[model samples]
Target: MTQPAFVAPGVVTAFCPKPTSHTGVVVMVAAKGDGVVVLDSGMAEPMPDALGPALELLGATTADVRAVLSTHGHRDHTGGSRALRDASGALTYFSADDEGLAGFAPDVPVTDGDVISSGDLRFEVVTTPGHTAGSVCFYEPTLKLLVAGDGVQGVGSARKLPVYYESGTRYRASLRKLLALEIDTLVVGHPLAWRGANTHVFTGAQCHELLEDSFAAAEAIRAAVAAVGPHPTPHRAALAVLATSPIFDHFDPGDPVEEDTEATLDSELRDLAGTAVR
Candidate 1:
């Protein structure tokens, strides 16, 4: 029984079970009716308990849900799709590029420039292939709100290690693309952090600052890859990065290494070699 709260007009935020501020969920209610839209479900089973509370926040119900937009194919984001759809019969959406992820099958395969409408909300999908091949952000121009799942990771989440499976080059480009948007509110899948501040929501200049910080962090990784060269042992290379990169905080070189960190380092190395292109 998670309590959902309004972060912006007509938009409610719910947290997945046992969530931190970094892993909050977003729900959008139609301005003209009871139609509801959920963005990025959750990571585990039984669906997110917050959904019911979110609907109540807007005076809506499961039957009023018209759409469920997944930011990417990551289970933490897409895991609740089937349950949500089963409950509300809402059309599910995710980038067709990510249909290959386990258990992902979007009712509407989304692409860049595609528009999804629910009630008065018209979300223009912006394809951002980085965190995952099909990572995307939904922007509603009228509200100036962008619901970016994992497409933008500042310095990573609570662990403070950014994760990107696809091309790091493309990830940086996606950050640049988001920086160009006219966004008043930015909602992300995790509490991505910058300089130790972490949250899933950003408003006004904080939005641009967060985008800039994310880009800068990605750029730092790129620079590290360039310095370390492409063939170094993955673990050693990651240690070298952790030792020198200011993008990471509260991390020590002696700490046990994370596989995703190593993977990101390898991906960046490939990017530097021009071999990571998707």
Candidate 2:
């Protein structure tokens, strides 16, 4: 039962109880009053059992929170959703595409452009399915704030690119969509590879700069895919690019470069499990 870290005036970032899970969601309080809303509930059994302690730390309660706005259906993101809803009497909403991964169905299956509001806080949902089929980001235009789910990833607070997930093409498009938005501060769901137990934050000019670099990486990945003739093994293509391109400023063939490209290589490579690539 750890309290979320204060990010700004009205926002706080919370974490899952487990060590493996870094970030769970962002909490937004009413601009002027007592209303509270959660971005995503961390993955916890019995729904949001840990949320009570977190809310306690924030000096709020399930009664104050009116809704749970989920960014995607990843277990880490949606695991505590059902419990949170039941406890807070909050309406839970997530993208339709992530039904399977989310395990439980949300009260509402929201799509792009949907609006979620609680008291004076308003968030516009932007669906960008790349990290997962139903991945999304929330934009508070008035605040110029972004609650970016797994759709974006990087090594530090300054993200130069979106982490590689399931689909390279879809991931590319999703990142581009996010970068196009006007944002003053960016809050992601989890810490980057280089950041441990620290909430990732990027603001002002740095937001645009890092996103631009990420976009460049996506563009380069697309070009590689095209050159490989459609269905090339993603790893091979990435390795080829790493060897020849400047996607990464430095790559040592002699050492394990896993940390440097954690976004692109970690889960994508490990998920291969025991499959043979003949």
RMSD of candidate 2 to the truth, in angstroms, is 6.2
Cα error, residue 55 of model 1, in Å, equals 1.6
Which residues of candidate 2, in runs, are more than 4 Å off? Answer: 1-3, 17-34, 46-49, 52-54, 155-162, 193-199, 223-237, 243-246, 249-278
Which has the greatest TM-score?
1
Q: Estimate each model's TM-score.
A: 0.88, 0.74
The Cα RMSD in angstroms, rounded to one decimal, for candidate 1 relative to the true structure is: 3.3
Question: For candidate 2, lDDT tens digit of each residue in 1-278?
Answer: 14555555667676565454223333322221246778778765644655665566567877777778788887777777777777768788888788898887888889989988755567899988767888988888877878887767643222223254666567767888887899898777665533233445677886766566656655565554445443445545555655455654433333443443445553434333323253
Global Cα lDDT for candidate 1: 0.74
- Candidate 2 residue pairs in clash (backbone atoms < 3 Å): 160-214, 161-214
- Model 1 regions more than 4 Å off: 1-3, 18-34, 230-232, 275-278
